[model samples]
Target: MIAERTEQADLLAGLRPDQWDAPTLCEGWRVREVVAHLTMPFRASLGRTMLDLAKARGDFNRMADTTARHDALQLSAADLLACMRQNIDHRWKPPGGGTHGALAHQVIHGLDVTVGLGLDRRVPPERVALVLTGMKPRNIKFFGTELDGLQLQATDVNWTHGTGTPVRGSAQDLLLFVCGRRLPPGRLSGTESP
Candidate 1:
């Protein structure tokens, strides 16, 4: 989590002011919104999070989306980055997932911003492998991917998953693909289009 946080902070720190408004792979969320979402767990209190979950009728997805959108409007890019840096060592854990969940959150969202911007921010293979190993079937489904008959092969790493129509790329790209991002062209190829 600390390494991912530092990598993300460095990447965001280098972005031009106008880039904050750029679109990310997270559908409606802009770059700033993604950053805001990244820092949400660090800034929001347990009571506030509970209230938010309640407001969404216990839908964690809605809570996260709405909170990210709402919080982005209240924070600047610099503030978002600062929050991330400040909480690099934070031990925020979800109900079922502990530190691994936090690491996955950081890595995946970090890719959402970087890949969405068409930037060349490659997450280290070690970190990507960690997240890959931690991915549960429910987690993949929650990310909106249907991997029933698909295979994932990482060209830049030894990791591979599933079997059937192969989707191949670098470990980072493969991670993003599994997480439901339509990667930029040429980043991935399959025996047939996925």
Candidate 2:
């Protein structure tokens, strides 16, 4: 979704100053905080990540939340968006994660804001595919839980994971599912929209 983010960032950059403080789906975080959080992960060196780990008590999500909370760039959403554009392609290694995992973070974070704001830009199909394919193994460690029991099958693409009853829909729907949105009544295991 790097390319899509480039396009998406352009849209975000143009948002009025007032919109930067808008609420996003990420609970208490505003759009500005989300942007700051996204920026904090780029090329985090061993030293910085270790500091984060200590701050998070070794939880990546906790670490990210902490960093975002403590980030100095809490003001000036325009500057944060500009930083996002500059760091859009920086390829964060996250101490021990793959580029695909970064792709997941990027797309999902994009959705957290876009979906919250009712924007129309979509994450690129290839980027989504890479994430869907990689989630099987990556999420085990990253999510600190089991996704094995969950069946994810995309309606708009040839995609499925796991083997039980399937939650199926367009790629975006599936992305929404993994991001923890409720499956639409008829979107799961069928072609009909809910």
Q: How many steric clashes between backbone atoms does each model show?
A: 0, 1
Cα error, residue 1 of model 1, in Å, equals 1.3
Candidate 1: residue 160 lDDT (0-100)? 90
With a 3 Å backbone cut-off (N, CA, C), the pairs that clash in candidate 1 are none
Query: Which portions of model 2 show Cα errors greater than 4 Å?
Result: 42-46, 138-141, 144-150, 181-194
By summed lDDT, the worst window of 10 consecutive residues in model 1 runs over 185-194
lDDT of 2 by residue, 1-194 (tens): 46866876888877877677787767677788788787776535679979888877888778877777666255477667778888767867444557776777777777778777777766766667777777755464443433455676886677877676666666765775666644336545633321
Tens-digit lDDT string for candidate 1 (12-42):
8899988899999888999989988888878
- Specify the highest-lDDT model's number: 1
- For each candidate in the order shown, give its overall lDDT on alpha carbons: 0.85, 0.69
Best by TM-score: 1
